[model samples]
Each structure stands twice: as structure tokens, then as C-alpha cells.
Target: MNDPSPAAWLRPMLAVHRRALAAGCAAVLARTAAGLSLPYLVKVGIDEGVVPGDPDALSWAVLGCAAVIAVQAAAARIETLALARVAQRMLHAVRSRLFAHLQRLSLDFHERERVGGVVARITGDVASMQPLVAEALVNLVTSLVTMAGVAVVLVVLDWRLALAVLAVAPFLAVLVAWFRRRSATAWRRVREASAAASAEARESVAAVAVLQAFRREEVTLGRLAGRYGEERVANRRPIDLASMFFPAVEFGGAAATAIALAVGGHRVIDGALEIGTLAAFLIYLRLLFDPVFQLSELFDSVQSGTAGAARVAGVLAQRPSVQDPPAPVPLPAAGAELRMSGVRFAYPRADGEPGPEALRGVDLVVPAGHTLALVGATGAGKSTIAKLLTRCYDPDAGQITLGGVDLRATSEDELRRAVAYVPQEPFLFAGTVLDNLLLGKPGHDRARAEAALAAIGAEPAFRRLDGGLDTPVGERGEQLAMGERQLLAFARLWIDAPGVLVLDEATGHLDEESEERVQEALRRLRRGRTVVVIAHRLTTVTEADQVAVIDGGRVAQADPPAELLAAGGPFAVLHDRWLRSAAAG
Candidate 1:
């Protein structure tokens, strides 16, 4: 499946940049026409000029040959540049399209796929296709045109010699067929191995900190070595095939040349063929095999390209599970009550079968301008509720509504502006704090961002950030302290000013001092916003207007924080444990 051989993917892309394609085609035609003129001119020079001692004819032929060569050189240059332009355009389109598609795919898709494997699709898979666009296209068009032109000229010059050269055609066909079949399989393995190696390399780099902490560097190195070993074997198979295949093609050409010599020599000796005509026929005969050699390499390029294209196409084939309604209802601007009714969901396996339900038939409602905290043991579906509230993954069996509009029916733009979810660790791109804050409102004034940071008391730390707000965050904002990143995330929420907020353990990992800063930001952020907090520590829920105790994918109890403890129900056990843990601390 990874080796779809027809290059069906290329047609649509070529159509997209057809003007450049047309220019490249025109250049190719001119080049081929100019090139084919040479042998005929050679025949003219020797037979009519040199042999007959005609000085004018000889001079004319020489000048004509030089002029044709010049035209061919110019056309070749134009063809290369024009096709390179089309190739670059296609590459840009493919990368941009792939990146945008990945962004639009549902969160479930990203979670189900590994980071490294997904990166390989956009990076390695697209890279594998470069040769086909950059070089193979030109080679393919040139070789086919050259071969066709040469074949006609050879037959025109001497039919008997043409027959001799044509005898090798069937042999070349069979050899090419064998090479393509074997090389296709070989290249598919190579591509798969390459993807695997790339995945391992990226995964190791991304997790290097953890590996070093655990001192498992050697183990990771061994695994990487294994992946690379497989890749080396996969690459070797194709090289071995090419080594044999190309030499065989050369041998076929040599045989054709020998056959042409024997037949054409007899004809010239018997006064059936002119020496000049035999010379022209032989010259054109050599043109035939140049294409054969080039075509053989072109086949290699085709195999690599098709293998990569199939993988790229496979990614594009995915349909997002979460899609906007055909005609969406607009979310209301204010007093948006977030509600989930009898919602049920199961994380899907990679094979598309549903796994165990992460959220059961549960229902809840968060009154506008109130904080609802979800407290639960790990994997008790606390985070699942937050995810559903944010519409990262839609509930399978029920509807979530905002302001009485079904979240599915509401426009995503309206939904996003109405709700903001902050993960435990927020990600920042590799840029200045200003660049990351620009994500909230790309063209917003710089002074406003600085004011938001100061409002959250993050300005002092940010101002000290070497370049102030312009300091690069490094990857994922690792350059800043964890507390700084969390505060920056809150500033984003402030800028966007979503009416509903979902915080998943956002303050769970901070030091006491940093926690105070983040807690202060949360207080300012939660005012008048319908807040949903998935709390890992019960201490975080004491201020909540309401708390829901989740157990085994269902809400065990839901009530105000004080009443839940006074009720002495299932919430008592969790509250008691938190009290003792807090006392111990």
C-alpha cells in the first residue's frame, strides 16, 4: 500500500501549477527538436560536403550544428529553471497542506498517533519526494522525447539498421519490468525503515531528559541502532538491484550497437547504404541508450516518490471526527451556561474500535459566573470532563450545550472565543513572549500585552527576561520558569477573555511562591467567568462554589465544598485524606 506505483498523486499538483509546467514543456520540446537536428546535419556534412568536396555545404552544416547546440543549451537551462520553480511550489503546497490538515485533525487523532510518527509523515515522507519533483520530471520528459525522436530518425536513415537496434527493445523491457517490481518492494521497505528510524531519533531527542535521569542512554542507543540497521538493509537492497540493473542496461545498449554495426556495414559495402548515412544512423542509435540509462534512474525516483506519496496521501485521507455542523448556530455572547447531559465517550483504539469508556452517562451543569471543581482519583474521568467542556473531543452519546446551543451545532469560532482550556503544562512556540502572546490577538498592540502581564503581576519577571517581553521562550517556553509559562497562559486567557474557563491541574506542580502568583492570576481570571477546574489536590477545591467527586467514570457526588464534607458521604473520604496530607505537609 505504501508503494502506489502510478504517481496518481502528482497529477493534481501538476495541474495546480500548470503554467510553469507548460513553460517547462515548451522548453523540453525546443531542446528535443534542436538535439534531433544534429545527426541529420552530420549526415548532410559528410555525404554532401566532405565526400563531394562541397565547401559551401560543409560550412553551412557546421554553422547549423553550432546554432542548434546553442538553442538546445538555452532551452535546457530554461527547462531546469521552470521545472524547479514548479517543484518548489509543489513542495510548499504539500507541506502547508499537510501541516494545516494535522492542525485540523481531532485531538483524539493526535493522542492516538505518536508525535514522532506524525512528524515523520510531514518531514521524512515529504523529503523522500524531492528528487522526483526536482530532477526526475525533467529526466523523464527529456528521455522519452529523446528516445522517440531518435527512433524515428534512425528508421528514416536506414530501416535495416533500425531493425537491428530494435531487436534489443524487448530485452530491455523485460529487464526494466523486473527491476521495477523488485525495486518497488525494496524502496517501500526503505521508506518504512526510514520512518521508523526517524521516529526513534525524534522520540529519543524529545525524551532525552527523562532517559538521562533514569540513566537509560545505552538502552535507547541500542534501540536506535536496531532501527538504523534495518534501514541500512532496506537501503542496500535497492542499491544492489541498481548496480545489477544499470550494468545490464549498458550491456543491452552495447549489444544493439554491435548489431547495428554488423548490419549497416554490409549495407554500406553492398552500395545499399551510404557511409555518411551509416554514421548518422549509428550516432542516433547511441541516443537511444542514453534515455534507457536515464529512464532506469527515473524509475528509482518514481519508486521513492510513490512510496512517500502514498504515506502522505494516507494522512490526508483521514476525516476529522469533530466537524462543524452544516449550518451552525451562533453561541450567545453572555450568561453562557455550560452543560453536559448524559454524556458518554470511549477513547478509540488505533484500529478505530472503541476502548473502555472514559466518561460514562454523566450529567452536570455549571451556572454562569460560578466555579465548578471536579475532584477525583487519577484516571477517574476528571480530565475527561474538562476535555469535553472544551470540546476537544465530543461526547459520543450526549450533547454539550452552551447558552442552550448544542456545542456541535455552534460555530467553532464562537465556541472557542466563549471557552478557554489551560492544560497543566502549556506549550509555547520558539519565539519571544510577544510572539506567543500575539497568538491571542495576532495584531494586538504590544502595550496591551505588557499591561495584561502587569495586571497578572507577571511583568516584573517578564521584564527581567533578558529581552523583556521579546525574549525568546526557547522550545515550548522552557526558557522561562514553569510558573512564568503558566502565568503567560493566564494572560492569554485574559486577552481572549473567554466567558468559560477550564483549568486542568494548572497550579498542581508549582512551588509555593509560584503557586501564589498563579492562584492570584486565577482569581482575577475566574471573576464572572464560568470556571471548571479539574483538581488533583483537594486544597484547590475549597474555594469552588461547587465540587463534583468523580469515581469510576461517574459522578459519585456533586455539592458545594462545605456541604459535601458536612454530608459525610463519598466526598468525606477524599476530603479527610487531603486534610491529613495537608496537615502532614
Candidate 2:
């Protein structure tokens, strides 16, 4: 997808800031014009009031200038409020759109990226643009207006002096250009270093327990320190470069003022100008150089913000590898007759060599409402088949059909609604048990939730909790034991009542008691639903209506467990191993 152009992204923000920008411009023009009148006020006091020794005229002019200062101060307050409103509204819109775009991205995109980095881009990077548009841009615009007004007035007084001041302007411009380039490079480094540091910190904290258990604290701390050092170094370069700008610009400003003073003084001494006119010229020179210097610094923020914008836009620009068809296939109302025919697949690999092939020319079928068991050792492509069934990824070469419809043509929403996945380790979102269950089917009433729990033999266990359905399952169901979590997952799937169930059997983690309960729940949940179980347990394998023993990405044996065991094939050997292992234990 073509990302939103800079202009396109800025248009909405422009609209949000339009009223404030207008109000701010009016306030700026009024305040700046009032400020410029100060030099004239001094001129009047010096030439007309003080030269004639008229104390009354001097007092009146002083009072008038004070009144103007008060009005300007008031206008400044109003302008600050107006600009703040504009920036806040614009950031809100930008952040909302960025967050929405993130939601629309594919799951694969998230898997490949880090949560911390993505969050930083959306929340942190978008925030960086606020001051660039609000204070910096606004200040620059107002300063330019003030500078232009002063220049025009200065020229009216003495064209020769104005030309000299203009000569100094180019030197300031060149200085600004140099600073902007240096700051842009430094800011990019700062953002990269910060993101790397944040990613490291997040990873370390997430795995802190494991790190401690493994006695890897020193190693992890060293890595964290290294990242922090990089960030500190990156941060220091900008400050160091910025340090040069202030002193250099200050010196330039002082030099410009001294030059203007000396030249204007000579003219005054020659009787070509009044003392008041010399005073006004010096004031204008100060006004001109101050903004020029400040604006140079503001330019740095602009360049940095643009770089951040490009990074954010780049993420929003990516097209998901998997997308819904132009004309989406409607979901089947009833359970699907899921099939995989001569499927071959490989994960994308970075090396030039061919990728790791997970599956090869394997065929299988599960009729509507029938259960199929896929049994294999680790890395034997059992889990890959489940992912394919749900269209998590498309096979490299073959077809996956659901209810006689090709999955590639089906809408993701339709497929997800039709299929329910029970991963080996189930993830539970924060909320009450009831809330997590209802996520499967929004508006799932309590009675239905209770009924689903009952059907899966979870009611007794669930009732044991102090608050029944309202019991909170701490983060990721940490409050629940692995077996209890498994039961809840089954209950959730049962509540969803999907057309198909894909269960990755919980084998090693559960205790004997939890395993029995989950196995019983699995039996009940599988009834009347088309189910595919990636079995690692002999009990589940024995109960499956059909078993496919996968080896080297192909089905080595496919039969009823009893029939296959009698045949002394791959299934028989696995069955014997399970029995022997069980007997020994």
C-alpha cells in the first residue's frame, strides 16, 4: 500500500490547527507590531520630550509604551493557549490514526517486530512532532514576520546601515544550515539508540526470572549497560552539537550589534541622524539577530521530526503478506469438511540456501463433525498443519479447503469465526474468567458460559473459585494452574462453539489429575464438532477415530489406532513406546 504522503498526513492536523493558527497569527502580528513601536516611543522620548526637557511628554510616552507592553503580554497568553490547543488536537488525531493503522497490520508483522519498539514509534515518535509544529514552527513564523517588519523600518531610516545588517544575515543562515545538518544526524542516532535500549530493557525484564534462575544476571546486566551506554553516547552528541550553536550564535549576535552601533554612531556624530534614530536602529538590530539565532535552533527540531515521521510512515506502508480476497468468500454456516491435498511448505530463511521445509506433499481430510488425530515427534510438521488449517499461512504448493471452499479466497473474519484454536499453552487476557470466556463470543450470557463450563466438566473447578465466573485470571492466567488454565481454554472454545476445533494437546505440563480432567473435557468438547488434535499422549491417540502418524512431513500411517497398531507400522511402534513409557513410569 502507498503510505500517506507528508502532505496527506499533515492535512488533518492542519485542519485541526487552522483556527488556532489564525488566532495565533493575529496575536503575533498585534504583539510584534506593538513591540516594534517601542523604538519609535524611545525616539519620541529622546528627540521631542528629553531634548526640550519636557518631563510631561516623557512621562506620557513612557506610560503609553507601558500600556502597549501590557496588551502584548495579554496577547501572548492567549496565543500560548491557542497554539497549545492546536498541538494537542493534532497529536490526538495523529496518535489515533497511528494506533488504528497498527491494529490493521498482519499478525506476522507483529511476530517479526518487537512490542516495545512499535509502541515507542506510535506513542513516543508521534509525540516528538508536537513541539515541531506547535512551539518551534509557530515561533519561527512569528519571528520571520517580526524580522521582516524590522528590516523594512531599518531600511527606511538608513539604507547603508540596512545593507550592512543584511550582509550579516547570510552568515547566520549558513550557521543555521550547518547546525541543522549536525542535529539531524545526532537526533537519528538518539532515536535508534533509545529504541535499542528500550528493546533490551523490555526483553530483560520479561525474562528476568529465567535469567536469575540460570544465574545469568551478570551477563544480562552487561548487555543492558552496553545498551544504556550507547543511548547516553548518542544523546550526548546532540547536546554537544547544540552547545556549539548557542555560544557561536551569541557571539555572532554581539558582533552584529557592535558593527551596527559603530556604523550608526558615526552617522549620528556626523549630524546625519538624531540620537533617537541611532537608538531605534540598535533596537531593530537586536530584534533581527535574536530571532535569526533562535530560528536556527528551531530548524534542528524540524529535521529530526521529519525523520521520525518517515519511520512511522514506513511501518504504516507495509502490505500484509496475507490479505483478504477482493471478493471474499462467505463462511459456511455448518461445520466444514477441512482438507489438505499434496501440501508442501517452507518457512522463509535469510540464508541464500533453500529454506527449512516443514511439510511436503501431504494429504489429509476430516469430514464435517469428524475428529482427526495427528501424532508425531517434535518438529515433525504436526503443528504446521494446524496453522495451515486455520489459514495462518498458506501452503507453498497445495490447497486447503473448508466446507468445499478454498481458504485463500475466504475472508479472515469468516475463517476465524468458523475455527477455534486451543494452543498448547493457552493465553488468557486480563479480566474475570467470564470476561475471557465471552471474548470468544461477545454477548455470551452467563447461562451460556456456565453451560459451556458444565459441558467441559469445568463447572466444579470453576465453582471452587471465591467469585465463581467473576474470578480474575491475573495476567495471562497466571492465577490458574496449567491444568486449570487448560480446562478454562476448553470451556472458552466450547462457549465459542465454533464449527471446527483445533487442539494442540497439553501433554508434559499438566499433572496426572489435571491431565485426566482436561482429557475428559477434550472428549466432551470434541463431540459433534469437526476436530483436529495434534496428540502427544497415548490416551488421546487411542480415543481418536482416525490417526495419521506423520514422519518427515508425510503421513507414514493413517488408520484407526487399533488397526494401525495391529498392522505393526509407524503407529504400532509409537503406540508400543507410549505403553512401555507409561508402564516404566
Candidate 3:
């Protein structure tokens, strides 16, 4: 889809609430009509009632004026309420769609974007459109209608006075055009500055712990201050322009009113016009210029909204880099068997240059229900292999298969159901223990959840908590210990029970006791499943049926642990170093 302009983006939302929008428009017109009638009513009271000393005419005119005001007030209230409803509903739809699209986008897209910026788009940027969508558009319409009505009434009162009023129109248009050009640019800068400030603040707060650990609080504070300063500087230009706009509009209205009064006063003196008619022309002048002033004021909000809509449209237009095949093949029931043939892959670089290859010519196989452990130094592509097997990224120049079915040809749903990858750092949402557990297998009640936790020997950890299964995990599971979070991850996997498992340094961050507990759980979880472990510690490799040593994006060696240890290859050297370090400790 092409990126929608502000009006185009709002059209669908407006269509959804078209009935309310129509009613609001009707209300605005009714209110404007009532307001326009007041000047003529004043003319009637002065000429036919007060000047003639007719008590009944005077009383009737006063009553008529009062009735018009009452109607105007009622209509104004209806317009306000109706427009507010439409604005809120449109905002709700916009927010929901943006959030859903962000989720559907590929992980590569997210990795390249700032979380703070994305959050700002969903929150502050979306909110900036409220004034424009809910009130400014309606106000613009109402002001134009009021202006037109007053113009017609002025002409009917006396063409000479109407011509005097019309003299200001050209100057008013020029002033408005100038203000719009300046203020639009100013307002766009303001929105950009505001978004930058918001992104900086969000990032700082999210990484407060890191800042504190590195003793860089002052540096972060300085950066935030700089961002806020830019936002303040950008805001000043629009505010100065708006201040000039309103007073300039007022001056034009005064000039036009003065012209009408001077001309009409001479005509009344010459007996060419009635006193009431001249009085009505002065009142109509004010009414005519009122809408012009209001529209000028609304211009700022409209500009901000336009910029926000553009940013939102850019996000919605992004198609995911990784997508499901149009016609996907189904994996067989025995698809747990995993293989990567001549696999080669590289990450994408920001400047469109080729990134260093993370994996190269990697041939490997793991039969169903067996475990293969990959041992390598950091950045040697151990995790990359796990990522490939789980289809996080397709190999650039090779094929991965499960049960002889190419990974790309298989449906995403089937592939995900068949293989599960647990990363080094386990993430938990803000919820209760039971809520996090239920995410793995929805609709399973407490009894089933407890069984999954118990099977991994993690039930006691939860039982020790204040509320057991109902205990709040806090944000990102901060309330729980790191080991506890890891155990919950294992328990989740136990419930999920995928046919294949990819453990990417799952126990790398745990302490000795925690590692022992997790290793016990891993043994139970691995039964009848094809398991691939990215080994960080030498201990994990010892039990694997076959150990593959990765070096410089290639498979350096693959053999049983005993044979590899005796061969004195890369794996032997790594194990010997680990053993020496262990003995020294």
C-alpha cells in the first residue's frame, strides 16, 4: 500500500463514523445560522422597535434574540459532543492498527529501528492528531460557513458597506497564506523535535540500570537535557508565528470594521441608509472576520497532524522482509529430523554493503530423537546455526530441511510447532506465574500448568513464592531471580512439547546451582525430541552423541566427545583449557 496523506489516512476512519460526523456538521451549520441571525435581530429592535417607541416590537425582538442565542448554545454543545466521539473512536482504531502492524513486521526491521521511536509513534505522535481530527476540521468547516453567511447578510443590509468589508478580503488572504507557509514548516520541526525528545527519554529510562552500573548518570542526564533543549528551541518558532497570526487577523478585522462604519455613517447622514442597517453592517463585519481568525489558529494543529500521519503511514506501508510462502508444503509427522546442507549466510549491513559471513558451507545432520551439541567461541556462528534451523533467517546460499522437506517450502505454523528455540536470556512479560505458563498452552487449567512445572522440578520454586502460581512476576519478571525465570522458560517448553528443540546457550548465564537444576530439567525435556544445544560450557558437550566444533564460519570437526578429546583438534584444545581453568578455580 502507498503511504497515505493525512486526509487519505483519515478518510477511512471518518467513514466509519460518518453518521456522527454528518450530525456534527449539521449542528455547526445550525449554530452558525443562529449566530448570524442575531445581528439582523438587533437591527430590527433598533429600527422597528426601540426607535419607533413601540413596546411590543421591542419586546418581540429581544425575545427573538434570546431564542437565537439559546439555539446556538444547544447546537454548539451537540457539535462538541458528537465530534469528540468520532475523534476518540478514530484514535482507537489508529492505535490498534499501528500496534498490530509492528508485531507483524519482521524481526530484522525491529532490530534496525529504535524501540523508543516506535513507542512515540504509537503514543505521542498519534495523540498529536487528536486536535486536528476531533476539532480543527470541524472548526475549519464551521468558520467557512459562518464567514459565508455573514458575507451574504452584509450584502443584503447594504451593498456599499458590503464592498467596504470586501476590501479587506485580499489582504486577509495574503496574510493567511504567508502565516500558513511559515507555520507549517515551524510546526513540522516542532513535531520532529518532540519525537526525538520522547525517544531519548524512553531509552534512558529503559536502560537506567546500565547507566547506573557504568556510573554514567551525568552523561545520560546531559544527553536528555540536550534533547529537551532542541524540543524547546523548535517550539519557539511556531509559537511566535501563532502569536503574530492572531493579532494580524484582529488588525484586519478592525480595519474592515472601521471602513464599513465610516462609509455607512456618511450614507445614514445623507439619508441613503437606515441607522439600524448601518449598525447591522458593523456587527456583520465582526462575524465575518471571526471565522478567518479561528481558521488561522487551527492551522498549527493541522500541520502537526499532517506530519504525524505521514510517520504513521510510513510504518503501515512497510512489508515484512520475511514472509510465509504463498503455497507452503506441510512437514511430515517425522519432520523432527534436521539437516543443513552446504549452508552459508551473512547479516545485512546498514550501508547496503555485504556483511561478514556468519556461517559458511556448514553441513550437519541430527536424526530424530538425538542430541547434537555445537561448541565454538563467541561469534563463531553457533547461535547463527540455531537461528537458521528455527527459520529466523533463511540461508543465503544453501538449504535446511526437516524430514527431507525444505525449510522454506514448509508452512511457518508447522515449522514453528515442530521446532522451538530458547535464547540465552529468557524474557517474561508482566503477569502472574500462571499467566506466563498458560501462554505456552492456552486453555489448559491450573492442574495441567502445575504438572508441567512439576515435571521440570520447578513447582517448589513457585510454591515458595508469596502467591504461588498467582504471584506477580513484575515487569520483565524483575521480581523473580534470573534462575527462576530460566526455570519458567523450561517449564513453558515442557508444556509446548515441540518435536525439535534448539537451546541457544540457555544455561550460559546461570550460576552453578541453577545450571545443575536446569541440566536436570533439560534431560527430562529432551526425551524423544531432536535436540541441538549451542554449548558455552565444556560440560554440556560431554554428553552429546556428537559434538561439532565451529571455527571461522566453518565446521572444524565433528566426532563423539571421547574421540574429539583424544584427537587434539580445536574441540580438544577448548576442552583442555576449560579443564585447566576449572582445576585452577
lDDT for each of the candidates? 0.86, 0.82, 0.86
Which candidate has the top score in TM-score?
A: 1
| For model 2, the run of ten residues with the poorest summed lDDT | 1-10
For residues 1-585, write the lDDT of model 3, one tens digit per residue: 233566666788799898999999999999989999999998999999978889899899999999999999999899999999999999999999999999988666787778888888899779988987987868887888988888888878887778866988998899999988898778777877888888899999999999999999999999999999999999899899889888989999899988888888999999999898888878888888878877877788887887777778878888776678889988866436788999999987765455999998999999888889999888999988988888878889999988889989977788888889988888899999889988878888999889998998888878999999999999999999888988898898878778888997767778889888888888888888899999887778887888999999999998888999888889889998989987997
TM-score preference between candidates 1 and 3, better one: 1
lDDT of 2 by residue, 73-177 (tens): 988987888888888887788788888878767655676678877877786677777777687757876798889999999999889988876777777778878
Q: Rank the candidates by TM-score, best first.
A: 1, 3, 2
TM-score of each: 0.96, 0.91, 0.93
TM-score for candidate 1, residues paired by index: 0.96
Candidate 1 off by > 4 Å: 1-9, 463-466
How many clashes (backbone atoms < 3 Å, residues ≥3 apart in a chain or on different chains) does model 2 have? 0
Off by over 4 Å in 3: 1-4, 332-335, 351-354
Per-residue error for 474 in candidate 2, Å, reads: 1.5
